[model samples]
Target: MSAKIEVIKNKILSENWFVLRNFTYDLTTKDGTTLRHRREVYDRGNGATILLYNREKNSIILTRQFRIATWVNGNENGMLIEACAGLLDNDSPEECIRKEAIEETGYAVGKVEKLYEMYMSPGGVTELIHFFAAEYDEGLRANAGGGVEDEDIDVIEIPFPQAWAMIKTGQIRDGKTVMLMQHALIEGWLSLT
Candidate 1:
């Protein structure tokens, strides 16, 4: 049984550079078919990646910014501490993160160590996040990291231990960012031991 997507309504709230909106939807289950129904309206989303680069001194690179959408989820106002990442227009996850690293943090990430591929919010929206981590040693620094025009970003550097602690204590609120950091810690990928 093929579960069909029955979209009750998809409205356009605001569409200029990107689109924003309030979408309401309901699903009519297929007879005898186990299909995912659109029971509740969905949140807006786009694809993104998280980059974890460990410099030679056991420090990791992170970014700080003001996230309006994050405040609604539970992140305290202003200051989304996240790894280097950005939207993937159509590029593969690996490619997207590599590019984002250079664009956002001016770091040239080497061969990325795949961490996780998952949806940021499976219950409401389709925001797939691809995560990777690499050593941020020599031959990785590029131009300073920052959004081209509109985004205000401040790079933050912290030792690996502190980063892991924050993830465990919920200080790191970005879903994908947290997942990537935790995976790296447990798997012994970013450890000196």
Candidate 2:
């Protein structure tokens, strides 16, 4: 299956936090039909997310933060519970996740196992997030992490069962958080009991 695609025009819409552009492309289908399509793409760059779990305590570290986009999209509180994540800016996915873990959760995680990569919103957003998981303990706490600068994050540790229940209760609506938790459960990283 091969489709010929040609970029017709590109216009920058915004470049504040990231690049947002409008692209017009001419595509020729396999049936010899040519179509012109216009799409707006938001290039916020790729990111990395980590789920920190403590096997002894049967708990996982998560973060809650305010999201303006979610709030505008009918989320009453606009606050979302999510895994520790950050954009991989000029660093490898592993390095970014490790730094983000300590910066957001205060856990100086050593070894992070890369799980997979996913496009959270492939239609309009050009972001591929690298997923990771690591074991953490209280002894590895380096500092009281709540993110840096203007990012206000609340670190929360919830029992495995409770965390899983949040998904069904609508409390844990973040996709990445849900994916990581389900991954942990399916992989037997979390104690079933």
| Candidate with the greatest lDDT versus the true structure | 2
Q: Write the per-residue lDDT of candidate 2 for residues 1-193, one digit (tens) a residue.
A: 8789999999999999899999999999988999999999999999999999998899999999999999999989899999999999999999999999989999999788999999999999999999999999988999989999989999999999999989899999999999999899999889658
lDDT (Cα atoms) of all candidates against the true structure: 0.70, 0.95
TM for candidate 2 is: 0.97
To one decimal, what is the Cα RMSD in angstroms of model 2 from the true structure? 1.1
Per residue, candidate 1 scores C-alpha lDDT tens digits across 1-193 of 6545555566766666465555554544746443433334344445556656564566778888899877887666757888887777778777887888887777877777776677766765656676677778646778888866888888777787888777778777776777766676677667633
Which residue ranges in model 1 land beyond 4 Å of their true spot?
A: 1-45, 72-76, 168-170
- Taking all chains together, each candidate's TM-score versus the true structure is 0.77, 0.97
Residues forming the 10-long window of minimal summed lDDT in candidate 1:
32-41
Give the C-alpha lDDT of model 2.
0.95
